[model samples]
Target: MVDTPAPGTVRPGGRTARVRETVLRTAGDLLAQGGFEALDLAEIARRAGVGKTTVYRRWGTPGTLAADLLDDMATQSVPRADTGSIEEDLRANAHLVVKTLTEPRQGRLFKALIAASLCDEQAAEALHRFYATRIEEWAGCVTDAVQRGELPDGTDAQRVIAAVSAPLYYTLLNTGDPLTEADADRAAKAALAAARAGTWSTAAPRGRPTPNCDN
Candidate 1:
């Protein structure tokens, strides 16, 4: 199981909200400028104008701090597109991902956070939740497509949405090649094809129960 962030991590409103905004922004700036290695609680507190004791007591470690930053980012994601066509919607989602991955500050910050997730359990859980949040936001388009008869009944919306961006993420992480609009378009088309092919609609075979590996 994943550990939760500590108290005073990110309050919802009022003056505490403003303080969190400033602190998260400062932390993001530092993370983008340098990487996970540069996340110092005292420095973040000084730069963000918050108390060092508050930062240390709230986050306790760099991994927890990075996790909180990721959580904040997940909450700030843009709403998904509803273009009346699954084709357009998936493409839009893909393009939006590419845009976020290619933008200077956000791109570097995302890369840094991904690196942090690889080595830190807290960061990994937060990152997983972050992606889950974004994927759920975009899954609506798939559900709408099914309702409109554009896709098969009982289609797995979240899986389809995840398929659309999986290859793009692979390209971003595995290859040094610059992500382009063409790449986004291709990924969107491929996922759409697979969805239409019942790749995500098939149910388990008769009497073939799913094996439980958690024992």
Candidate 2:
């Protein structure tokens, strides 16, 4: 008898992965075109040339599907830059964010995901996970800088990383302003300055993991 994998499990590659890739690509296309409300399972299956039952069986709800997509994106994202200089690394991170948010398809897809997250707990959780993954990856830059004495000891790496991305997201979500290289540079500079000024210090040595900034 053939074995069957559990639902939502990631396969290295095969027909299962092919179907998933097709469905997710189609779902992302629909989302970019019409936002969260457009993520109909039957439509996704149709566009992806997969069976509606297969799509439904794999991912029952739009929220869950969106969450899965976000998880996939997190895994697929580029690793943080290790440029040996905190300023350069932060600037690279900021520029990468600007590149993503300004790219036509990616920007619309993100807005759709954000809309889904606003109304769906699963999507929200996945979105949080996505950012946390990104922040954790970038936090190493700050920690390395601290070790190199470029940043003060006890600087909160995650907080400094989040600060680098925060203002860029604000411009995307709030001001609706065009993001330029200048904006990216400024965000990196401000966060680096803050790190130098002990703005995100934990008041303790860097032996333990710093407390999460959400508190």
Please list the Cα RMSD from the true structure of every candidate, rounded to 1 decimal place. 5.9, 5.9
Model 2: residues with Cα > 4 Å off, grouped in runs:
1-12, 204-215
TM-score of 2: 0.90
- Best-fitting candidate, measured by TM-score? 2
Task: Please write out the lDDT profile of model 1 over residues 82-195, one tens digit for every residue.
Answer: 999999999999999999999999998998999999999999999999999999999999999989988877789999999988998888889878999999999999999998
* Residue 100 of model 2, lDDT score: 96
Candidate 1 deviation (Cα RMSD) = 5.9
- Segments of candidate 1 deviating more than 4 angstroms: 1-5, 8-12, 203-215
| Candidate 2 C-alpha lDDT tens digits along 1-215 | 97875455555688989888888888999999999999999999999999989999988888888988898999999999999999999999999999999999999999999999999998999999999999999899999998999988889899998998899999999999999999999999999998888898866655678789998
TM-score of each: 0.89, 0.90
lDDT of each: 0.90, 0.91
RMSD of 2: 5.9
Candidate 1 TM-score, true structure as reference:
0.89
Each prediction's total of clashing residue pairs, residues at least 3 apart in sequence or on different chains, is 0, 0
